[model samples]
Target: MGQKLIVGISDWKIGRGDDVLVTYALGSCIGTCLYDRTTGISGLSHIMLPDSTAIIDGHTTRMKFADTALPDMLEKMKAMGAMQGAIKAKIAGGAIMFQTSNSKFNIGQRNIEAVKAALQKLRIPIIAEDTGLNYGRTMTFWAENGAVEISSTVMGKKMI
Candidate 1:
């Protein structure tokens, strides 16, 4: 698997073969991974916000929002020969790093919800996930076999 392809905040990666995609330090953000078992193609997106409609003041990156990023990742995967019908999703890292009281603006929960909504709209099934908690996470997606490995000091390691 060559060097691990890093999916930074507001970024996404897709590849086949033994490609590995990783995202580090997720806090109040969502990391969504998609894989096509039939083609051994995979994609991972690290989205920082729930939606892009709210940020209208200036030019904003489409990948920075879950609503946009998820679809973008899917399109990228399709462009790389991934069939939508054969794609399955796995998501990790939607944690409330700082618990708040007075508002419903829990970014983590919002991000998770946004990702789910987008996937649902696209008819993509999510087979596994680790989300909604108070701990940050780092995730890696293996393109060769469509496996995802998650790591976190608070929750140890898991492959889903």
Candidate 2:
């Protein structure tokens, strides 16, 4: 199959062939990559926040927050015939963009911690990550080959 590319904020794309899911400019945000090698089905979520509790109703889009989006992404993959046990995860793009005196509103740190906590709760192991930096990032997940590439204006592109 030919290559398929997807791009945006708070978006996710799943692939079973030669498709790539990519998100750019991840600053004070996080991206999660989920892949099932056996089925060659992979997914990625670009989340801007840790939780959606303040949003109320609890019925926003499934990609809105890390706490909700991660689990939902896994479920979607499983429904598409991806085996739970075969799924591997990679995370990136949690940067403390600005130096601040107060730590309470450290969105980047909160985002990273929240993602780790959510993954732990789901019993999914994080095989790799490039987080907690002070820069922005662009992440590309090549589902066809189970490859995840990360790029930053300061760091350039590198495999994670």
The lDDT of model 1 is: 0.87
List of clashing residue pairs for candidate 2: none
Residue 91 in candidate 1, Cα distance off native in Å: 0.3
Listed in order, each prediction's TM-score against the native is 0.95, 0.93
- For lDDT, the strongest prediction is 1
- Stretches of candidate 2 off by over 4 Å are 57-59
Q: lDDT per residue, candidate 1, 52-126, as tens digits?
A: 897877687898998888888898888888899999999987888887894476878888889999999989999
Tens-digit per-residue lDDT, 8-43, candidate 2: 677776777888888888888898998898999898
**Clash totals for all models, in order?**
0, 0
TM-score, cand. 2: 0.93
RMSD of each: 1.3, 1.5
Residue pairs in collision within model 1: none
**Residue 124: error of model 2 in Å?**
1.1
Worst 10 residues of 2 by lDDT: 1-10
Candidate 2 at residue 149, lDDT?
89
